[model samples]
Target: MTMRIVAGIVISAVVGVALAVTASYALATSNAPDREVEDAITTGNLRAGVVVEYGTR
Candidate 1:
């Protein structure tokens, strides 16, 4: 349905933004420019749980 498609798009976009911000925060805090992000932390399952994990900053 159109509503479902729109919701999916919105959710995907939001997740993408969250991934970017979290990655940036981790990158900034770690102070390791040479190290890749995947080596820093896994950005999977952007739920309330993961949000709490990333909320330390």
Candidate 2:
């Protein structure tokens, strides 16, 4: 049905936007090399799970 087709298209578009945003965030964060150290020390915790895994500034 036409409604089904329209719903499918909307779903695809939403998925595409999510993927693009994630990709952009990854790219932006990829520039920093000492991200883990910086984040851990700043937050006063050495736990691997405590630091933000992203490479962003």
Candidate 3:
């Protein structure tokens, strides 16, 4: 019975970590911008952070 409880706790911790990682990646992707837009702002072949788009039409 003790072994079973320990196993369950370990499994739950692993699953929780996985879920947290997945959620973080999803949020990161949503905030990230495309490569081209980033290039225009930096004026170099650099890439990072969110890329915001603006239009005058």
Ranking by TM-score: 3, 2, 1
Write the residue-wise lDDT of candidate 1 on 1-57 in tens digits: 999999999999999999999999998878754333453456543546432343343
Model 2 TM-score is: 0.58
Better of 2 and 3 by lDDT: 3
Please provide TM-scores, in order, for all candidate models, with all chains considered together: 0.53, 0.58, 0.59
Instruction: Estimate every model's Cα lDDT from 0 to 1.
Output: 0.72, 0.82, 0.84
C-alpha RMSD in Å of predicted model 2 compared with the true structure = 9.4
Question: Which 10 residues in a row give candidate 1 its minimum summed lDDT?
Answer: 48-57
Top lDDT hit = 3
Q: For model 3, how does the per-residue alpha-carbon lDDT over 1-57 read when each residue is reduced to its tens digit?
A: 999999999999999999999999999999898866786778865458745558434
1 or 2, greater by lDDT: 2
Better of 1 and 3 by lDDT: 3
Give the winner by TM-score. 3
